[model samples]
Target chain A: MTKKTKWFANGYLTLVFVLLYVPIFYLIMYSFSTGKTMSHYQGFTWAHYVALFQDARMIQIALDTLLLALLSALIATAIGSLGALGIYATKKRQTRNALLSLNNILMVSPDVIIGASFLIFFTFLGIGLGFGSVLMSHIAFEIPIVVLMVLPRLQEMSTTMIDAAEDLGASSWQVLSRVILPAIIPGILAGYFMAFTYSLDDFAVTFFVTGNGFETLSIEIYARARQGIDLEVNALSGILFVFALLLVVGYYLLTQYTAKRQKAGVKRP
Target chain B: MKRKQVLFEMPYFFWLAFFVIAPILLIAYQSFFNIRGQFTLGNYATYFTSATYLRMTLNSVWYAFLITLFTLLISYPTAYFLHYTKHKQLWLLLIILPTWINLLLKAYAFIGIFSQDGSVNQFLTFIGIGPQQILFTDASFLFVATYIQIPFMILPIFNAIEDLQPSYINASRDLGANNWQTFTRIIFPMTMSGVKAGVQAVFIPSLSLFMLTRLIGGNRVITLGTAIEEHFLVTMNWGMGSTIGVVLIIAMFIIMSLTGEHKKKGRKHND
Candidate 1:
């Protein structure tokens, strides 16, 4: 491209990046302000962070959110990986496609629809709306994503390896544990990570199902935000910003490491 | 072996039945019931006949359209230009990083920026316009919604652009076509799938940004999502909410069908 256009493109990209990052940084920046509102930065102080740490309710909710994400992601990964495996092993294309579409219903449905429907589903089943309801909903919504993530890896695997394992007298369980699982471990991890993030980031579904007694961080922020500006939320955002950054970095590194290892394995063989 | 495999897959099947299929059927069934628990088609009747509900649906679609339009306009060029940049993957990751932050926190951030004494107001005041009420306005809502959706739009389009073969552009140039002509005839047409995917990603969610309407729109802008939330949570009208949920699902399907990849036709095999 010409220098003028190149400059223009660079400028445009810089502008878009600024727009994207400004809000996030603005929130994080105000977390240090001694002022009560985000509008004014009266001076820098760690008071909001200190308050965030000391607020017992907020701390408990954060821990609960973490626990919920971990448990849901774990269960979803196991079930979803097996679902992907089953889909792969299906001889009929129609059954496989039907299953795939069924799996994606939750992925495409708007969160409100999912939340409303799940609320109805829970109430109909006589399931009380609380931790149990929230956990189940998270697992439900998370499974589809986990399936999507792992299915591609399953497809990429060579079927001959499974046949070879069977010919060597490996049981189905042995084949799964020793042959298939190791090959798709990266996809499984990726699915688990995605599920964890989805559960953590989810608001609407959790909001609809969560009883008055239980609130995730998103619901709490929503409640607090409606009341007006609170720097404690900003403090939480600052910490979350760091946490999300670490997660992305870690995920990126993990994927890169796996890719390198795969290349090395291929080269050796 | 077959039995073992079926047993292994049992949980997934159970999940499919209980979570996916059952909730959908339950929602559809619930839509037939009125608020007082009587089984009737009144909720659908109310949604279809009521002027207020009709107007709200139209407004919600319009706002979502606007958000999608603006997001596309901004993101297309960003993605197009981003393709030529060094370290584009890293740049794309940076684009995606904001999304990882809790959406509520981002919305909360805008509350501060657009508030009376927020940065935008301060800029306005500096420009001699003085501080106007930027928050809770249609403009602020549109801006934030578009902002939130930009990364999603960009990612798909960038992938599409990256997927474009350089040979096509070079061939177009060799055939005496200029840059604009080449882009319109070759690059843009090839990237249509990505644009469709981007729209699919942005438009559906845009229709149901209930939290945005409440926090940024100041209840001035009521989307389908806001209505559903109000019905389910505030008014305790699960029936009406489910009716709206069904409508959203239908809308989702319509969009999916419209944007979904159509199979290529009429290609003859050379024997």
Candidate 2:
């Protein structure tokens, strides 16, 4: 607000940012170092990065992680969006509220609880633990988030549009594909991305549900980290860091573009 | 349309009933039974009667509370500061960006920071102080926990403060309110919802922090989360693990109730 206060704020903000970024900077620096220990900086080398990419196990795990995220996110988004639509379509307020509260169980429950329950349930079902269990677990937790994301968007949409589409003799399927889907596409996309990221970042849930030679990146990182970390892990993390940054930037740009288009459309109309 | 809606919801409803509801029900079921399939309250009895288990739960709540408290204290001012800054969006983005990075990576990075002969101790040594042990201590654990939580706490508070109309502050000023008075009477009360939301976000996750308890705390700090992990993974005791899981669910609900999130929703409906 004032000059002195402005300077003070800048100083405080800088310190906070430094605290946030310095550890990450340290990790990135060590990833390139030829040394194994995190403490020292040795001759610069790309050996860690090379090893990270070249390792068959790491490559497989990375692919598995991506595949799991994609599949789980897709399944969750589909079911969740439909669930949102159905919940919205319900005429009775009581049923809608009941369904929402049911959804909140998955949303609020700790991952450990979810993970443990899933683990026991799968064990009980004699499914054991592997890709299927992990994927199911991801979808189970992810659905609620997707529903929450899409529900608000659906609620904001004017019901008159749907009514008009039906009145115009459009089939239910046609109205869904052409009208409802198009109107809530952004929410669906948002839900998908959120679900995907949650799947990718998840550890505890995956940890509990994964066994019998299955591994995701987080699980692998946890295992390796417990044995004391190697620089290859740092290399993997650096690459993932860059990937996440790019994703965030892309999302930001996409939102900005949509906002601009919306504003332009409003002005034109 | 209603029939079509039901058709669409059928698969999801089955999934929720089986995967979402059934698993929690399974936990509740397992918690009541022992390994021999005999119905018993042994799990709950063990949790409530054992001093060690009770202490672990207390530690979980205590550490989680401190983490939330420290995060709020740090983030509130930061959010308030960012609310006035010109590049508020950019600053907010910067704050939130790290959360995109995996929690494990961030925790791993802090390992380097608090390690012996690491940057922190190295800096202390540079300042003519002895190299201090920062790793595996309560302080390091709390520090890392708070670090991970800051962004989550900041965003909500920032949004809440930003949402406040400047006219309200001006009106308070016009009525002869000083900055402190205005902040106390208007700003703090209005932004409390955000604070509660932030606390909920940070506090809930901090409760079940398993990996960090091992990596950062070095097995020194044992929480209910780590205990659950131990019961399920190490001991192969599903009943005990399920019991702990059930307790955590109840605790989660209690926290939700304390935050008054459901009550707020009801108030909004009434409005």
Cα-based TM-score, every candidate: 0.98, 0.97
In order, candidate lDDTs are 0.93, 0.89
Which is the leading candidate under TM-score?
A: 1
Using DockQ as the measure, the top candidate is 1
- Per-prediction DockQ comes to 0.89, 0.74
**What is the Å distance of residue B268 in model 2 from its true position?**
6.5
Candidate 1 per-residue lDDT over residues B106-156, each given as its tens digit: 899999999999999999999999999989999999999999999999999
Candidate 1 positional error at B195, Å: 1.0
lDDT of 1 at B102: 92
State the lDDT of candidate 2 residue by residue for B247-267, as single tens digits: 888889899889867457868
Off by over 4 Å in 2: B261-271
